[model samples]
Target: MDTITVKRRVMMPIRAGDVMAEFISFQGDRSGKEHIGISFEGKTPSFASHVPLVRLHSECLTGDVFGSGRCDCGEQLDEAIDLINQEGGYILYLRQEGRGIGLYAKLEAYALQDKGFDTYQANDMLNLPEDGRDFRIAAQMLKALGVSKIRLLTNNPDKARQLIMYGIDITEQVPTKVHVNQYNHHYLKTKADRKCHTMTFDD
Candidate 1:
């Protein structure tokens, strides 16, 4: 695990209402990836509490920027912003695109998905790890933010496990809303069934 330190903090406003956001940068990240920590709090004075509700969101250009329905990244991001704004927390926007396989490989996996391969299977076909995200960075970010304990806002158990492994005291595991649609039904299913993400679909 890389030893990380707070490089800078910038105040910024986002689209998710009147929340107070402090974007953070880090130093000593071995990967040299620009991971950002967007901390939202104090907008609703009474909603702010002791323990922060933190979210570790990986980068997804296709889904987050273009609103692609092939996955729920964008929706989850939007939801995280709103919920974290209300509850008071941090959103660690990691630059781990396509589960750490890079954009092109992710696209290749997508091509394989079009041929009936599951997300993991497509990655396997590409000789790539199914999920190569390292949550140690997230833990380091939280530590830099002076947070040792958190109520994590995510459905992925792996996130919690990794955070715990990296010395983040997970006080609670908060599940995100399941965003399932025609374009991402199978994708979400693969996440739930194979990845063990906590997802319950509507009947």
Candidate 2:
């Protein structure tokens, strides 16, 4: 594993609902991009010996930031934050918008999904891989933060595999699920069926 040089650390605050989180920023390998780590302060230290409950959430501008109902990314993020606050953990907000296809391609995928194409098929049509995120940098960041193992919070199995492949010990897998809406039902199914995400529709 390569060493990550944290150029600087910045303290910032994010207000979500009634909760205000204090976060730290580390300048990552990429220039102009800083990895933000939300602090679970009190509860997190208790789980440090065990696997930290970590979440590697890819950037979802529409769903995460804009509260778009086309997917449950935003809801899941909120849930992760709340859980982490109580149980203690971290959220790695990767900038791999649209599963690493970037914003425009994700928008195109959204159009295709609207036209009845599932998420994977739409990305395939756009000549993009189903998921193009690389967790190597995440592993490096975790190492920098002194995290040796993690009980990851996610439905995506590939994320677990990728993190382990990059040498981060995965002690357990925790699933994150949100109730499906009319807009995101098939989209969620494609993630479960095609992407091998652990989400169950029965929930």
Candidate 3:
């Protein structure tokens, strides 16, 4: 595996609601593409030669940043932050937009979903991979941060397997579940059924 070049690290205060967190940023590379790492201070010791609770979360600018209800991505991100804050771990924020298919294609897929297609089927219609995200960059970033193992927080089992395949030891799996609404119910189901995401819906 190629070593990621850490261009710089900086400390900044992050304010979300009433919670203020001290975060460190590490700019690095994964498979030649730039990636960023944001680590929040936790109650537990940092990097004690064991796997930290790591959330390898992908970027969802529309849902996470803008709070768009088109999907549950935003809710999931908030949940991850809360868990990591409590458990004292790291969140590897990946820039894989639209599951690595990019924003334009994701928007196209959204249109297909509106026309009566599931998320996977919408990608299929667009000749895009159901999920194009690659976690190799995440692995590199983790190693650079001195993380050897991780209790990964995600609903997608493939994420766990992929990270392990990239030489990061995965000690446990943390499931992320969010309530679904009229807009994202089917999209979540498609992820569970087709993409092998471990999500359960009460409704």
Candidate 4:
């Protein structure tokens, strides 16, 4: 794996309101995507004492920007900011939109989803991998930040598994809350059942 370095660091106040984070840009990212890291120093002594919390969030245009309820992406991003802020961590905002199938392909898959296909099924119909995200870059980002160990903040086991494979020491895995609603209930269920995401439905 090639070494990636921090290109820039700026104090950016996100929409989360009064939450200040040190936004970091990387140089020589193998993926050639404009991935970013948002760092929040741990406020509490207990949180600061532990390994940093980390979140590898893929890009979701519909969910993150427009607040679309079709998936939990937006809510998860928002939640990550607050949680990581309180617990000293970094949120690696990856540009692997739509599970790395790109925006257009994702929309096409969404059409299949509207036609009664499950999320993974839709991807299969489109001849795309069930999950195309690569966490090696995330590991590289952590290395650039001088961190080899972390308490990962995610429900997806693949994230932890991949990070471990790429030489990141995952001291712990923290599960995100299930943000299920009518529009995203089935989508979330498919993730829990098919993708093995750690989630529990109230229904």
TM-score of each: 0.95, 0.88, 0.89, 0.96
> Candidate 2 vs candidate 4: which has greater lDDT?
4
Worst 10 residues of 3 by lDDT: 22-31
lDDT digits (tens) for residues 35-74 of candidate 3: 6676766665645424567888788889988998888888
Which lDDT tens digits does candidate 1 get at residues 37-73?
9988634555235689888999999999999999999
Provide the clashing-pair count of each candidate structure: 0, 0, 1, 0
RMSD score of candidate 3 (Å)? 2.7
Question: Model 3, residue 42: displacement in angstroms?
Answer: 1.2
Ten-residue segment with the worst summed lDDT in candidate 2?
A: 41-50
Candidates in order have lDDT scores of: 0.90, 0.77, 0.77, 0.92
Error of 2 at 55 (Å): 0.8
lDDT (Cα, tens digit) per residue for candidate 4, span 1-203 = 67899999999877755888999999996667999999998677594447998999999999999999999999999999888888898999999999999999999999999999999999999999999998899999999999999999999999999999999998889999999888999999999999899999887
After superposition, candidate 4 runs with Cα above 4 Å error: 47-49
Candidate 3 error regions (>4 Å): 16-33, 44-50
| Comparing 1 and 2 on TM-score, the stronger one | 1
Off by over 4 Å in 1: 16-19, 44-48
- Displacement of residue 105 (Cα, Å) in model 1 is 0.5
